[model samples]
Target: RSPSLNLSFLYFCQLMATRGRGRGRVGRGGRAGRGGRGGDQQPDPLNQQQPPIFQQPPPHQHPPVFQQPPPNQGQNHVQIMGQFRVLSPPTFTGADGPQAVDDWFMNLERIFEVLNYSDQEKIVCSRFQMIGDAGRWWSDVWRLKTTAERDAMTWEQMKLLISERYYPYHFREQMERQFYALQQGNLSVEEYEREFTRLSHFAPHMVDTDFKKSRRFLNGLQKDLRFVLSSHGYLTYAETILRAQQIAASQRLELDAAQQTVAQPRMIQPVSVQPPSFQPVQVQPAVYQQSSAQPSGSGGKRNFEGKKKKNQQNKKGGNGGRGDRQPAQQTPRARPP
Candidate 1:
């Protein structure tokens, strides 16, 4: 019993020592944590609790400070497919021109509606012209003119300007090759130029330049429609216009005929006829007629005849004598057809 009690006492002492060591370690750890978290101080390296520096935000992560732009910032060249191109026509001073040359073609497209060009020829041609001319006009400022100068330009000059300046770069490049080929005696400039000009006329962008001149050109070409048919392409826009116009005229004639048919007066028919009325004829009573014939009974013929003469006289006077000659009531009658 004595040895067992001694062993129990030894176990209690060991347990108390273990508890004291654990409390001392915990208190030291708490002091270290509080010291590392002190205000206005960084944590000690050994005691640092946050994620590593690499995991934290970089010093340059903040946005750049705001600054005033330079005076001409608005006119800066806009980037296009890695190339910076002028944003607007240098002549234009307002907000920079639309982002793409397609905007310029939009004006031509709008005009296409008014010109009644529904086929793809004008659309494709005008777009090519718009894209081509932007590059050309960008390189050459003199090509654009004041409104007055544009208005004063002759139709021939306008057509030449459009073909020379506004045609698509690829198409013009091909034309240049042919022009050089013609120069080398491989082809004739007149024939090739005529072909190129006729073909280029269908591009959508070409319509933006001198549309009135284009109409005139088409009209002139119509006189020599045989040449248009013989062209290498065998596709003439002049022919398209002629066809569209024929359709419009035919439609107009049809509409006019329809209007005439609508405007003609309509004939109305009578549904029924009214028959003539038959009225009853009132005849005098036999007794009244006999009395009138005799005229002799009121004690003597002279007295009765005197009364009859008086009644006759009253009726002739338009009085219809008061006591004995009331007017008869007549029935209503239908009108004759």
Candidate 2:
């Protein structure tokens, strides 16, 4: 062989040795080395098991997707409910008047304010409190709404719905009238203010402003209190109430003082006069005089005797004789047999 031929043979041998080393490396770890066909007979791609072509996930098997709630959502809900029940919230049954419904709403609002509840939370809490007729009514109302509408329901909307059902228009009108006619006649200042505040809800437009509220409150006050408060410039409702209370207290004190200072009428003791003593006069018995001579039956005979006697007396006087006149003889009367 020529020198070029020998050089070619040596290059071929080096090439073969490099290829053998490459094959050994592949046989140790490459796919073809792992019990696969050792040659360039690349396993038929069609027959080779490809990594499961990532088969389009079965209709049921979806990609890892996330939902709205976390794994501990139920636990969180239970915790919230536990906290809510601790407040001792009030319930409703639609068995009372419109006022009762309003009171229930007010009570719930107070509790909600303390809890800082959101509108949806308020709706949830309020619904949980409904029972009996109230629960049934809410069910009907709820059935009328779509899921979106239900989810979007706000606290005010819930109140309005309950109001519409339990608090009818006529009843609300009546309450408004009562609110307008409310007076502080016999109620104390605090009591009157409380009542006024409560009824004010029925006619919100009437007392929309402080001036109107003050005016309305003044109008309902007693005549004396109203008179005293009316003389000053406009005041807020609270200020007016405070002033009226002060005036009322002063008036009561004045009345008490006047009562204490007033002197009670003195009871007069009746004068007893002793009656005059009566003196009895002693009466004397009359004495009886008996005549010595009996009466004569003949009146003529007695007259003749009397004339004779008188004549005798005159003769004696004429002769100046001191002779005594003799008594005439009396004739006795005979008794009839």
The stretch of ten residues in a row with the least summed lDDT in candidate 1 is 77-86
lDDT tens digits, residue span 150-245, model 1: 446543453345445444467556544543322212323234335545444444354445554344334433333324433433334555445434
Candidate 1 whole-model C-alpha lDDT, 0 to 1:
0.45
Residue 120, candidate 2: C-alpha displacement in angstroms: 2.2
On TM-score, the candidate that comes out on top is 2
Per-residue lDDT of 73-181 in model 2, one digit per residue for the tens? 4676666667778999888999988889989988888888888888877877788889999999898888999999988989999999898889899987988999999
Provide the TM-score for each candidate, comma-separated: 0.17, 0.57
Candidate 1 has a TM-score of 0.17
Clashes of each: 12, 0
